[model samples]
Target: MYRYTDFDAAFVAERNAQFRAQVERRIDGSLTEDEFKPLRLMNGLYLQLHAYMLRVAIPYGTLSSAQMRQLAYIAERWDKGYGHFTTRQNIQFNWPQLRDVPDMLDALAEVQMHAIQTSGNTIRNVTADHFAGAAADEIADPRPVAELIRQWSTDHPEFQFLPRKFKIAVTGSPNDRAVTKAHDIGLRMVRNDAGEPGFEVIVGGGLGRTPMIGKVVRDFLPEADLLPYLEAVVSVWNLLGRRDNKYKSRIKITVHEHGIDDIRARVEERFALLRPAFIGVDQQLFAQIKPDFAPPAFKDRDTAPFDQAYSNDPVFRSWADTNLSAHRAPGHAIAQISLKAHGATPGDATADQMRVMADLAERYGYDELRISHEQNVVLPHVHKADLPAIHAALKAAGLATANIGKISDIIACPGMDYCALATARSIPIAQEIATRFDQLKLEHEVGDLKIKISGCINACGHHHVGHIGILGLDRAGVENYQITLGGDHTETAAIGQRTGPGFSADEIVPAIERIVDTYLSERDSADEAFIDTFRRVGMTPFKTALYGESDKKQKAA
Candidate 1:
């Protein structure tokens, strides 16, 4: 919850003004579509298959009630009546009129938010663990470092136009809720032997046509040397990364082409040269930013209401069991509000739903909200006493789906429905899967599953990291969905392994069902999760379940 300073306000105002003029020129025929492409992209505008899409950054996925309200207002006023929360913890307005974009930008600026660096080949929004400040196991909050990186990367002269887009994710907890290993630069906070908090830096991890887990470049980077070390990493990659081919332009590919050891050596060399200039300036800025994220003044109260509801109401109990995470403070919980209600779009929230969440945050959640990378809204610090009322409000708003980490709680992208680059539709596939599982009443039975879907090989939906990953492709002229098993997004991150062949769109849901049924039958006990079963048994059983035993035997032979 970093408040915008006068300088921050002025900077955003100036950028908005500049973009407003740029948008005006494009509308007036002063610039052609091709001519204005990069200009619009720089401002987080995309001309999708049908209309313009505007992506607004939510730095470290933190938002105030006022900011959330303004986002709801923008969604209702300019675009459709809803906004899509993305895997990067940003929101996308999918159907904005070209002329209204500047107005939307201006409205976002009013709340100290913007869409800058959300697109194009520069560093995208710096993301962190959604439970950064509230996670019970965190060494320290990662948002201060995330915000510092955001400030340093925004419009940086040297990095404005890198060979490809870059992403950085930080997690304060060792459990890695932020999927740090899949980012260009992943910072996992850790305490050294001397008890000093530092970062374990991972580099070269990315998912697209080529998916690779990031390598540990720096086992332990001191907090003070973070900025300089980060600069050195990016600088080395900027020079070494491919510009000739966009496919190989990412730093991950660069890291792959050059060994991690060589890359580390180069980064260290660059760090030696760059470290002198920083001289603790970044640390000073970080110190100033850190206070803004101080823990909210939590009220100590009896949890009698929550206890009563949990004991009496099965509905409330189910929601609480699924949606709540342990908080750092006593008598507090982190409540995850599901956007993926059964049969609904995975990451979309209606304006009304947004307002309800904003109200709940303001009234019961210490006036703060967080957007998790899993496409859920989080009240990072809510008293357990308020669970019943909060659950009631969410139920009324169609947000109380007790499916967090369940089979129905999927992560998917707006595939062929909106994205121009998509090959097949992701929304319908996700909806069908969720609805199918819900109708069968097997979500709770399935337990702690992640099913991620992508429209194409771009992996925008992060299918590479899901326990059951679905990648929708256009096979010749038909929509074919491929499945990957055993992928994990936690501390032991691994790219999913694909099962043989692809299923028709009609066969995809049933295929998923077969996979789940296989897990249930093969697991040693009910306590074993789908991921654990997949890992323990390996792909042999799942492959036989997906493809036939004949095909499994064929592969073995």
Candidate 2:
């Protein structure tokens, strides 16, 4: 993790003090709600449906034990006893009082964390692969570049306010764990013919009312040119993106209106001008940041305890099978702690749960923690020998759900529960689906599936890329849920196709069950996942299953 320097500390302190003054003025009637909106947004504060919400950024999803403990403390002292981890790998405190926000900010500053750029039209938190340095398949760790981008963009005068919010995601692995394709700027590290690692830069990808898989603007860009190239891309879009209509303000829309070729040409032109200004300063900073992300000194330990537990305890076996990923270090595993436990809200962790995870990370995980974009906490470098003890601790904390990438491990946004822009409730729907699948005991049977739910067309839950995507909307004051199938968020990214008419809230869960049952029956073998089956068989079978034979016949005719 990147430690904050004196300059970093001073910068955050000054920003916090400014926000404190701004908060005081708002309370004193010096600034009205409308007047304080932008200021508060710049600080990552939002006036939600019920109360104020504060979003704190977790850069590249990396956290030290002390930072995690501070977050738990903030959750307990300022807001509700739980904080919601978001799809962007940030945390949201939903019940913070406006008056106490400054205090909360101060508390976060003490831990070298801040809420800045977590929201608003500027670049949000620069996300990377959660398993950046630990993933066995990584080309190189992407965190140093991510950190460099963060430092460059934090308060850049040119990009403080863009036409709309922009997001950038980076992944060093070939497997695409970061969902790089769905970001404004997606950087996938790849090796050139010379065998040097570089980035495959993808641009114009976004999901909302309009979902798009980013186009590869550069097949291979040298690692040294990353910062300048990124600046060129954003700079071109910042000037060309629409400001007349908020609906079409994103870079995705801009790229759609102008051909990718034109956009590429313009970015190249801009790069030629900006490259000199950035000669080698960014690379120098990147070199400095690289040491902070070096791999932990892993111990040569026996895996006998892990093997014993897997062989003896079915519970531990199930959890280890589902929640663990291969680690680069020998006898090490990546442990994913599920927040979506049965009926619990997805991406939420209680203060006690947070503390438990913090303690486990300190004890067994080399004092490192990561927040996955899938709404789970990751102990990226846990030795296999520590698995039994860690599993026991997690089970006691209600965090040991063996449902990673399973049907019950859903990704859902706050929706109407907290968001003012939501049309219907997403949290309850997610809870119902997870609970229904758990009760049926078919989650493991259903296999690896991603069910993403967004309360509206905003796609905050990334519904557009889910294998079974659910979009909740209000139709004539009643909640209607729409379903999309075959969407993928991996390297071969594709936007999901809608299955046809929306279902009532009562019918949504059953509809999902029908889709799963249909997949099970139609798949060539048990090994064929739902997505592969959907792709092979197309939407006819699932559509017939969802809309009945009569509707299927009607469409056929």
Candidate 3:
């Protein structure tokens, strides 16, 4: 993990101090709620359904053991005992009082973290692959690039206030684990024809009211030209991007309105001017940041013990099958600590659990942690020999939920409960579905399903790409959810098809249950997952079940 330099430390403390004073001003009426709203939001504070919610950025989703402990501390001291990890690779503290957020920022600054750019229309948190350094198929660790971009984008004079919130994601691996297709700017680390590493830049891809897959602006952006090229892309968008209509304000729309060729041409024109001016930091700055992310040295222990353990423990075998990922290092695996424990909230990790994970990270694994886009915590580079001990320690902390990629592992946004723009609730809906599935123990039977929920058409919860997608809507002040089926998010990604009429908030769960039951009865085999069956048969059964109707023949008659 990258430690903050003194300059970084001082900057955060200064920002926190300013925020603390602002909070005092707001409480004393020197700042009205309207006056304070933007200021508060700029610092990652939100006025939620009940109380204020504070979102803290975990840049590139990498955290040190110490930082994890601090997050746990914040969860314990300020708000609810639990914190929700979000799809953007950020964490949200759901119940913080407005007055306490400044203090929370202060605490974060101590660990070289802050909430700046966590919110606001400015470029939001720069996210990357969770398994950056540890992934077997990485070209260069994307974090250094992410960090460089973070520093560049943070309060950049030019892009401080864009037409809309800008998001950027980097992935070192060729496997596209970072959901690059769904971001405003997607930088996939790639090699040129000559084998020199660079970025394959994709622009315009986003999931919103208008979901469009991004187009490649640059086929191969060289290593040294990365920052300048990115600046060029943003500059072109800032100048030519939409501003009149908020719906069409995104860069994706800009790219759509003006074709990729024009955008690329404009970007190239912009790049020529910007490239020469960035003489301050080049490969040297990267060289400085590289050492901070040096891979941890592990004991060259025998893997024979791990094989023996797996043979003896069937439970561990199942967990290993579902939760473990390959690591770059020999005899090591990345461990996913699933928050989707049956009936519990999908991404809520308690303060105690965070502490336990920190301890586990320091002890059994490398003193490193990652927050997955699927709302799970990852302990990257854990020795296989430590799996038993790690499992036991996790079990003790109530953090050993072996439900990674299962039905219970849902991705949801802070819908009506927290987001001001939400028309319906997402968390509670996710909870209901998870609980129902757990009670039936039918997650395994259902198999490899992604049930995503977004409060509205913004699609932050990624309802557009879910295997069984649910979008919450407002129907005359009543919360309703629309279901979409047969969506995918991989190389085979597609928007899910809507079954029929939307269901009331209360009715959505049982409706989902009916859909699941229909799948169970109609499926070819359990081996054929919900998605495979949906692809094979189409949405007729699920639609019939949801709409409370007979076949189309009866309707036509």
Candidate 4:
């Protein structure tokens, strides 16, 4: 909820004006497609399979009602009537005309939002835990630090064109809902034994063709040194990160090739030089931003109506049990609005639904909303008293899906449908699995399963960290789906292990069912979650379930 200052407003306005002129030049043939590629990417515009895709940054996944309304307007007025909320805590307008992009950017600017740094080789959107300020377990709101990174990285001269695209994420809670370990620089807000809040910096972690968990670079960094230390980390990478091979150019690769200790030493050397340049300016900004993030004035109210609704409506009870999280306030709860309605496209919210969410936020959620990395919208501070009303509105708008962490709550990238780099379709695979689970009525029974699908190894769906990871590939022009078991996107982050053989598109869903069936059979009880069971039994039983003993022996052979 950080409002733009005059300088911030002017900066965005200037960037928009420049981009608008650049777009006009491209349209007029002054700039060819090849000439315009980098320019367009710099402004978060990409030419996808069918049309221009504009990714707009929802910084740290925080949005006000007004901003939400603006996005709805953009979706309705320029592109298709829906926007795809991505796993990176950003939204993608998949069918925008190149001519309409400048107007879209201008509209976004009016609401303190923009497409800047949403794409390209520069630091992309800085993300944080969706439950940043409202989560009960948080040590501090990580958004302040995320915002600080946003300010520091935006149009930073040194990082304009790094070795490759960089991503950063922060999480306030020890639960690690933000998938911090999968980012270029992962900052976990923590306090030392002395009780001073700071960051637990992790580097080298990423999920792609090669998945590796990030290593702890600094055990505990003081709050004051965050920006400088981050600069040092990136500075070291910029100087030594591979440039010849695009596939090997990420900071994660750099950290992997060179040991963490060497990288840490280099970062410290750079930190000594950059520390003075910050000179208290970033902390001053942090102080200015902190006041805006003060917790909402929560009302003290009875939960009688909520209890009545829960008892009277089984639908409401199911949704509340699955989608709601405990809040720090006595009467408030965090409401996660599922974008993944059964068989529908995951993360694709219709304009009307967006408008409904905006209205609900304004009326019942302290005018705030958050986009979860799992492709759901979160009303972070909804009072228990408002749950019934909010649920009713969401149900009417087709935004109410009871599945939260269930098998149907899938994370899928916009694969062959929209992405040019994809070899196979991911959306249909996710749809098939979700629809299959829904038909079987097995989601609740399965319990707390994460199914992430990627069209390719780029891992935009974060398949590597999924409890059940599916990677889609093109094997001899045939769509082949590979499964990885035991991946976790939490404090205990680990890369999933690949199971035996890839399944055909038609075979993938049933393969997943077998895996789930295996889990259910192997679990101590239903109380044990899918992930817990997987970790307990390891991958053998699941592999045996998916590929059988003969197939496993054949694969091993």
Candidate 5:
């Protein structure tokens, strides 16, 4: 994990002190809720339906053991006993009190963490592949670039109040684990024809009322020109993106309306003006940041013990199958500690669980841990030979779940349960869906499906990008769940099509079962996954099964 520099420490400490005073002022009635809204949002606090929610940034989803312990303390001492990890690689406390937010911010600052840019979007948490430094397929680590953007964008005087929030994501691997296409700006690390690493910059990609895959503005931008080029992109969008209509304010919508060619032309003009002035931030600075994220020491060993454990222990065997991966280094493996614990909340990893993860990272693994966009933790460089011992520790700590890239592994938001803006509850719906899928034991057979649930149209749960996506909406105070099929999150990403009429909370799970069952029966082969099958067949049968085939407006023969 990257430790905070003295500059980083001082900045957060000052921000904490200021937010604490602001909270006091709000409590004493010196500042009305309206007056405090922007201030609170700047500190990553929001006034939800029941109480205030505080979003704390976990930069690039990395946490230290001590930091994890502090998060546990905050959860236990302040709000509820659990915290929800989000898709943005941030954590949200749904029940934070207005009075305690300052204290919470201070606690985070101690861990060199803060709530800045977590909410209200100003270049919100520059996320990357959770397995960036550890992934076997990575060309170069993306965190140094992500962190560099984080520093450049934080409280940027030019961009504090844009028409809408902005998001940026970077990925080191050819595999898009970070869902870069679902971000306002997605930067994939790539090599040019000349064989020098650079970025393939994509713009205006996001998931919301209007879901879109970003357009490639720069096919190959040299590694040295990242910041200046990024600044140009944001500057163009900030000035020209719509402000007249909130629905049309997002950069995605603007890009769609204005066309990518026009946007690219404007960005080029801006880049021309600013590129020279930003010469200070060159490849040298990136080289400096690399050492800060260097891998920890590991002893060379063999994988014999792990092979033996898998041969003997069934539970360890299952975990090894679902959670372990081949590492780039010999004797090492990547352990994906699942956040999906049977029927528990999908992304809610208990404070204790976080501590266990941190300890494992500090001990058997590399003093390093990563939180995936799927809301799971990764021990990126654990010795494969030590898999048995690591599995034992994980099981004892209650961090054993044998579902990764399976239906039980759901990406969900704190819906009506915690969010004021949400019309329906997302956590319980996710729980029910996960439990149902677990009972079926058909997730792996179904294979590589993403099930995302969002509480509302904001699309926080990435419902737009799931192979099987669900959106929860409140109709006449009754919770109604909407289903979409065939959405994907790969190189060939596609938005799901709506199945049909909405289902009541009680009817939602069964409806999903019908769809999955239909796919199972109708699929050409077991190898033809849910997405492939859905792509082939469309949602007509799923709709007919849910709403009788006769309900179809198109006259049936």
Candidate 6:
């Protein structure tokens, strides 16, 4: 993990002190709610439905054990007894009081974390593949580049108030775990025909009321040109993006109105102007950041204990099968600790669970932890020899659900429960679905299914990318649910197609069950996953299953 330097520490301390004063002024009525809105949002504080929500940035999803412990302390002391890990690789304290936010920010600063740029129109937290440095398929760790972007974009005067909020994601693996296609600016680390590593830059991709996959602006940009090139892209968007209508303010909309060719031409012209400003400072910083991410000292250990546990304990074996990913180091595996315990909220981690994860990371995971975009915590470099002890610890802490990529492993937003923008409830729906599937015991049999739900079209839960995507809407003051089929979030990304007609809240679960049953009946074999079958046969079968054959016949007529 990157440690904060003296300068970084001083800067955060000053920010915290300033914000504490600002909060006191607000409480004392020196600043009205309208006056304080922009200030609070700039500091990652939002007034939600019931209370204020504080979003803290976990840069590139990397955290030290001490940082994890600090987050646990904040959750236990200030907010509710738990914190919600979000799809953006940040954590949200949904019940934070207005006065306690300054204290929370101070606590985060102690752990080299802060809430800066988390909620503002400035560059939000730069995210990457959670398995960045440890993944077997990674060509290079994307964090160094992400860290560079973080350094450059934080409070950049030029980009502080863009047309709207901007997001950037980087992925080093050929596999697109970072959802590059769905970001405002996505960078895929790839090699050129010359075998030199560089970035394939994609811009203007986003999902909201109007969802579009990002377009590739540059097929290959040299590694040294990243900072200058990114500056140019944002500059182009900042100038040409719409401000008259908030709905059309995003860079995606700009890309749609102005053709990609025109946008690319502008970006190239701006790149030439900005290229002189970033001569060598950014590359020099990259050289400094690279050493911090070197692989841990892996031990040569006997795997007898891990092998014995897998052979004997069915529970541990099931967890190992579901919650582990391949690691670059031999005898090591990436352990995904599920926050989505059956019948519980999807990404909410109790303070005690956070502490346990911190301790486990300290004890066996080389003091490193990662938060995945899938709303799970990852011990990215867990030795197989220590899997049994880690599993036992996780089980005791209620963090062992063993459904990483299964039907129960869902992604859900705060929805109406916390978000004021939501039109309907999302958390309860996610809880019901997870509980219903757990009762069926058919999750393992279903295999590699993703169910994402969003309370509104903001798509915070990434409903557009799920194998079975559910979007909750309000129809005539009643809650209704819409389903989309055949979505994917991997290297082959595709937005789901709607199944037509909406279901009542009460009918949504049974409707999902019918769809799953239909998949089972239609699949050639168990080897064919839900997504595979959906792609093979298209939406006809799932639509028929949800709305009967008569629905299609009526349309035909």
Tell me how many clashing residue pairs each candidate has: 0, 0, 1, 0, 1, 0
Deviation (Å) of 453 in candidate 3:
1.2
- 57-138, model 1: which lDDT tens digit per residue? 9999999999999999999999889999999999999999989998999999899999999999999999999998999999
Best by lDDT: 2
Instruction: Name the runs in model 4 displaced over 4 angstroms.
Output: 552-557
Error of 3 at 164 (Å): 1.0
Please estimate how well model 2 matches the true structure, expressed as its whole-model Cα lDDT: 0.95
Q: How accurate is candidate 4 locally (lDDT)?
A: 0.93
**Where does model 3 exceed 4 Å of error?**
517-529, 540-551, 554-557
Error of 4 at 181 (Å): 0.6
- Tens digits of per-residue lDDT for model 6 on 292-352? 8888999889889999999999999999999999999989999999988988899999899
lDDT of each: 0.94, 0.95, 0.87, 0.93, 0.85, 0.93
Superior by TM-score: candidate 3 or candidate 5: 5
Where model 2 places Cα greater than 4 Å from the true spot, the runs are none
lDDT of 2 by residue, 1-557 (tens): 79998999999999999999999999999999999999999999999999999999999999988999999999999987999999999999999999999999999999899999998999999999999899999999999989998999999899999999999999999999999999999999999999999999999999999999999999999999998999999999999999999999999999999989999999999999999998787888888889988888999999999999999999999999999999999999999999999999999999999999999999999999999999999999999999999999999999999999999899999999999999999999999999999999999988999999999999999999999999999999999999999899999999999999999999999999999999899989888998899999999989889888887679779
Question: What is candidate 5's lDDT per residue for 263-304, written digit by digit as tens?
Answer: 999999999999989767556666677788887776887778
- TM-score per prediction, in order, is 0.99, 0.99, 0.94, 0.99, 0.96, 0.99
Q: Clashes in model 2: which pairs?
A: none
